[model samples]
Target: MRAYHLDAPRLDALRLVDVPQPRPGMGEVLVRLRAASLNYVDLAVATGAFPAALPLIPVADGAGEVMEIGPGVSGLTEGERVIPHFLPDWSAGPLPPLASRRMRGITMPGSLAECAVVPAAGLVPIPSHLSFAEAATLPIAATTAWRAVRTGAVRPGSTVLLLGTGGVSLFALQFAKASGARVIITSSSDAKLDRARALGADETINYAAVPDWDRQVLELTGGAGADLVVETGGAKTFARSLNAAAAEGTVFVIGFLSGGDLEASLFPIILKMLRVIGSNTGSVADLREAVRAIDATGLRPVVDRVHDFADATGAYETLSRGGHFGKIAITLEHGHRAQL
Candidate 1:
């Protein structure tokens, strides 16, 4: 089986090679990957920034068909489409211990392989409404958004502020809209702001024009601040997220796309009595809820670009440029079978 291997924990360690195909153990399933999508985590892992997740294939989320199931596995059949849960053991509620969560491409060999083994419970059935590439983006981005909204208690008539036009932020906008929240999106690009409005955002802010975007957000919400914030941009906008939150509001710190370091003031937190929450990846139940919400709302994953596995290096190059919107996908080769 062909897989991208990290020969050593260096930026240049990534290489394509034919390695032994993985087989499933008891209660595991071997998935024949049809598509895999890139997240910022893939970039960090490839660049050797995260030493904690060393010596593994990069990419945490993917969609594929079940080719085989291991002993004692039930309720899953051959040819069913599925995705790997980022936190397989976390069925619901709060995040599991750091010692226990096994991320697909980070801690373990991820979906970059032609075939990979995962615990059966870690595989969530993909919706028929989505293609392999579309469904591949769900586990991380969509699930994180679902968890953010659910944990932050987003409700109808609530006002929500979303940062950037990235995958998770966009999904957050979609979910907030479906729940009747007035959505406000922030972006450095005006064109992306327009696109976000088309997806039901009530208003848009160009963060570059008004670097103090929190004031703009407050103005949009009549100075009450937003009820919840889908804060995917990291340190560069953390202080702004704090400013954007309403009295007793919630901010879900989910990503650091801008940078990992943040500058924030303690005064607003104490005065407003706000809830500052952080989200990692979500549980299996959250992934299922994401599937349901997307299906119910008729929302589909937007593909900014697609690349075949044979030319994935070109895809990586294009992804590195960083102007694209939505998910970047690579379809896998066919004729691969899973062995349990």
Candidate 2:
């Protein structure tokens, strides 16, 4: 099997090499991966910003066909399409006490290869309406956004403020719109903001031109501000998210895309009675709900770019530079099954 490996604990050390294909062990399934998506965390893993064992295959989001199921695996079958849970052990319940230890690419081997062996219980069927590339984007980015939006309790007439046009923000926009929420999104690029408007964004703020976008958000909402803010920019934007939120609104911190050290005051939070919560990528149940909503609404995940497996490193570079508006995917070749 062809796979990219973090031969050492350095971002520049990612390399492609051929290795023996793995087979499913007891209660495990062997998956022939068709597509995988890149995440910022994948970059952290490669660069050793996130702790990982050496010689690790590194990518958390993937969708593939069940090529083989080992003994004791009953729910899955050969040729069935599936996606592995990003945090396999945190299946359908409250967050596990040891979630960090079970996360893919950190504590476990990930889905950057043509084939991988995962416990069958961790695989969820992909929605039939979604192509492999779209399904591949859901396990991490979309699920986290889903949990964030859900935590905000979005409903009809609620306003959702998104920090950027990245994967999680766009998915949050789609979900918020589907629930009849008013969606306000920000981006540095006017063209990207235009695209976001076409995708149901009620208002788009050019953060580059309007350095204080939180004020614009407040203006757009008639001083009440947004009911929910999907805070992807972390340290750099969390303060602004708080500034843009309604008095009783919630800010769900999903990523540190703009870097992680926060320097913000808690005075506004106390005055407004706000809720500031942190979201790791959600449970398997969250993924199921996201897929169901996508399936029902015919929503499609935006793929900013797709690179062939041979150029997986280039995909990482694109993600690292923050040049993409949506998920960056890597496609593999493995006969007819590879057409994801």
Candidate 3:
């Protein structure tokens, strides 16, 4: 089998090499990977910002077919399609301590290869409606968005404010719309905002044009502000997200694409009686619920770019450029073209 190994922290250290095909052990399943999607955290891993063991196969999200089922794994069989959960330990309910440190790409070998062996407990059946590339985008981005929206307890006709048109924000936009919530999406690019509008974003703000976009959000909501804010921009935008959030609303922290550290006051949080929730990727139950919702709504993940397996490094570079609007996927099967 072929795999990409991060022998060191630099993206240049990511090397493609042949490795022995792994056989499933007790309670584990061997996946013949079809596609894997890159996340911002993947970039962090490549740069050593996220600690990982050396010679690690780095990528947290993948979708493929079950080629072999290990002993004691009864619910899955060979030829069944499945997606690997990013965090193997946090399978359900509240996240357990130290689970993030043990996440697939961070502490364990991930699925950026032709084959991967994953615990059966962390695998979710892929919906029949989605292709491998689409299913590959689910485990991390989609599940995190699911947790964020559900944490906000968004109701019908409520408002959701998304920081950007990235994977998580786009997923949040789609899910919020599915739940009958009005979505307000922000982007520096007008073209991206237009795209968000097409995806059912009730209002789109070019944050670059309107630097005080939170005020625009308040105006759009008749000065009440958004009921939920998916704050992916982190330090650069967290304070504004707090400004744009309605009293008693929730600002779910999912990403730090703009950098993690923030210089902000805690006064708004107290004055507005707001809740700031830090959300990791998600649990297995969360993934299951997201899969059901995607199946029911026929919602498709927004894939920004698809790179051939040989160009995995280029895929990482693309993600680093921050030019992509949604998930960037890499196809692993030889001659298997990714559906962009």
Candidate with top TM-score is 3
Candidate 2's TM-score reads 0.96
Residues 240-321 of candidate 1: C-alpha lDDT, one tens digit per residue? 8999999999988988777887678988889999898887868898899899888887898867887777665665666678
State the lDDT of candidate 3 residue by residue for 1-340, as single tens digits.
Answer: 8999999999999999999999999999999999999999999999988777777999999999999999999888789999999987677877788845468777888979999989899999999989899999999999999988899998798899998888999999999999999999999999999899999999999998999999999999999999999998989899999999999999999888778888999998999999999987889899999999999999999998889999999999999988788899999879578664
Q: Show model 3 residue runs off by greater than 4 Å.
A: 99-101
Q: What are the Cα lDDT values of the candidates?
A: 0.82, 0.87, 0.91
Q: How many residue pairs clash in each candidate?
A: 1, 0, 0
By TM-score, is 1 or 2 better? Answer: 2
Q: State which candidate, 1 or 2, has the greater lDDT.
A: 2
Which 10-residue span in candidate 3 carries the lowest summed lDDT? 93-102
Off by over 4 Å in 2: 334-340
Give the alpha carbon lDDT tens digit for every residue of 268-300 in model 2. 799999999988888988988888888899999
Lowest summed lDDT across 10 adjacent residues in model 2 is found at: 331-340
Best-first order by lDDT: 3, 2, 1
In Å, residue 236's CA in model 1 sits off its true spot by 1.7
lDDT for model 3, on a 0 to 1 scale?
Answer: 0.91
Q: Between prediction 1 and prediction 3, which has the larger TM-score?
A: 3
